[model samples]
Target: MARFLLIHGSAHGAWCYRELIPALTALGHQATAIDLPSHGDDPTPYQEATLSGYADRIVSELQAIGEEVILLGHSMGGYPISLAAERLPERVKHLVYLCAYVPKPGFSLNDRRREAEEQPLMEAIQLTEDGLGWTVGDDDLNRLFYHDCPPGTVDLAKAHLTIQAREPSTVSIETTARYAAIPRSYIRCINDGTIPPSYQVTMSEDWPSERVFSMDCGHSPFFADPTGLAGRLDQIARDIT
Candidate 1:
């Protein structure tokens, strides 16, 4: 069975994968989730966060594991995982982007969003007074990221979501041929209101058909459809092996 490292998206901590982790484990796979700096319980200040710091955190985890594992990145998590793959390609058996950014050599999250055919998360952002972070409006959070999620799920998300740092959003990722050589796949959320489904398709048009998959649920499928999500992830991990 494949070992999996699940990275959460913007304003989210590893706690967000509570359901998906167990579901993946039920498939007889070892799944682990980690909080990025300033997220969850981490004490790093939001103003101090950087893209390199995010990547380094991921790379440290991979190095400690000392074995190749499937690295799954959600939302903004994609950029850091890409950097991790670049730094330790041999330690990453596969890179999976779940309604996540599919970065190119010199594009930041903001840059990609600007280039997107359509973006749904932009209007939902509530920037911090200090200009170091942003948060989604409470009402928009349910609509944008968890429309299909179960009742009470939105409340849980609201309670746990951290203020996402802005530094990483402006930092563009740099991918090399070596990182490109690492097998990558994308799981598109067709019902996604955060990142439009059309935009997801646009970003992955060049990828082979087999490398792209879709979920009927919204962005937060881990909460909306854990069984289906887990099954698809299991199949993806198996296919590459």
Candidate 2:
């Protein structure tokens, strides 16, 4: 069975993967998720959260796992997972980008978002007064993230979502051959409202045809179709192995 490490996106924590974790386990693979600094129950202040801090937490978890794992990053999670793999390539068997940003050398996630042809998510973001963090607007959250999700998903998200530190998205990252050598895959959410499906295609256009998969759901597949997402991940595990 393949072991999986799942990382969440902006303002979200491990709680977002509640459905998918058990679904994957039922499929005979091991899956674990963690709260990045300042997210979920993490006590770190949003002002203190940084991209490197996120990467460090992921690295520590990988070291504790003590074995190779398939690292999956959802949305803004791609940056940290990429950095973690760069730091401990030996512990990562593959990197999976799930409707997530794939970092370009020297470019921050914010830079990539700005580069996208369409700025669909811009309307939903509410910047804090200090300019250090952002939160999703209440009205836009359901429309952008959970339009296709189950009944309780939006409520769960509303209760747990926290301020997303802007620093992490503003900092650029550098990767070397160590990170490039790892197997990589991308799962595009075809109906994603936050990150346009067309942009997802643009991001993964250069990847091998076999490495790019698509889901017919919006941004939050964990709640929309957790079992299907787990099955797709299982297929990815098999394909890579």
Candidate 3:
């Protein structure tokens, strides 16, 4: 069985993968899903969090595993995961980006977002009064992040969704290698409104391995199809090995 380290996106915690972890674990893969800094119980202040801060958090988590593991990142978590894999490529067996940004060196998440149609939607997202963070209000939650999700699942996320840190989202990424050096794969969600499918296809073009998969779900595939998602991840792991 392959060991997997799953990273969550902006404002989301390990709680986002609660449904998927058990499914992956039941398949005999050891999955470690942890909250990003300042998002969950990490206790880091949002004001102090940067892209490097987030990358440091991922590296710290990767260090705990004695064996090489598949490093899977979602949404904004992709930036840090890419950096983490570069820093310790040996420990990262393969990098799986789920509708996440896969950027070149010195590029920021904003750069990737600008290359897509997501900029307009991001600019329209609600922000805190200080303009330090971004979040979707209850009215836009279903349409933005999980339109295809079951109404009940959307309601559950509405109750649990909290404000995401703007600091991390705005921070630029600094890296040494192009993502093409790693055995990378893209898991595109076909109907995602938040991340335009056009942009996903463009980003995957730069991947070295080019092992791409698609789900007919929205941005939050883990919530929409945890079992199917986990099965695909397992298959990818096996194919790579």
Candidate 4:
């Protein structure tokens, strides 16, 4: 069984994978999700969050694991996961970008978003007074990211969502050949409003066809269809291993 280390996106935490972990486990895989620094229960201050620091936490998780595992990054998580891959390429069986960014070397999430055709979250973003963190209004959050999600998922998320630190997203990730050598996969959400679907296609155009997947869902596929998401993940694990 492949052990998948799930990484959540901006403003979310390990709590975002409440349904996914169980679904993956039911499919005979071991899955675990952790809060990245300032998100969820972690007390790290958002102002202090750094891109490298985020990657360090992921590397620490890999160091603690008994074997190489599938590392799946959701949304903004792509950045740090790439950094983790660079640090421990052999520790990752496959690097899966779940409706997440597949950044170029030295490009920050901010840089990548600027290259997008649609800036869905542009108006929704509410930055902190100190310019350290960001959040979205509940109305925009529901419209943009949770439009296709099941009822109550948005509410559950709204209550738990934290102020996303800008430091990490703005900081460029330094990737090397080792990061490129790891097998990679990208799951594109076709109906996604948060990140344009066409942009996703453009981002992973160079990726091998077999590893690029498309789901008939919105931004948060893990919430929209955890079972389907797990099935896709299962297929990847099976094909790769």
Cα-lDDT of candidate 3 = 0.80
* Candidate 3 runs further than 4 Å off: 118-120, 177-180, 206-210
Per-residue lDDT for 1-241 in model 1, tens only? 9999999999899998899989999999999999999998788988998889999999999999989999999988889999989998999999999999878767898898888877688888889999899999888988898888889998998889989999998988777887989998999999898888898898888899999999999989899998899999999988988
Best model per lDDT: 2
Q: Tell me model 1's lDDT, rounded to 2 decimals.
A: 0.90
Tens digits of lDDT, candidate 2, 1-241: 9999999999999999999999999999999999999999999999999999999999999999999999999999999999999999999999999999999988999999988888888887899999899998888888999999988878888999999999999989999999999999999999999988898999999999999999999998988999999998999999988
List residue ranges in candidate 2 displaced over 4 A. none
lDDT scores of the candidates, listed in order: 0.90, 0.94, 0.80, 0.91
| TM-score per model over all chains | 0.98, 0.99, 0.92, 0.98
lDDT of 4 by residue, 95-166 (tens): 999999888866779899989988999999998999889899988988888888889988898789999999
Better of 2 and 3 by lDDT: 2
Summarize candidate 3's per-residue lDDT along 1-241 as a digit string, tens digits: 8999999887788888989999999898999988777776678766666777777878888887868889999988888898787777778888999999886555678777887855536644788787777777777777768777656877777665666777665666565554446787899988887889889888886555449998888899998899989988988988988
Clashing pairs in 3: none
What's the CA error at residue 148 for candidate 3, in Å? 1.8
**lDDT for predicted candidate 4 compared with the true structure:** 0.91
Model 4 sits at a Cα RMSD from the real structure of 0.9
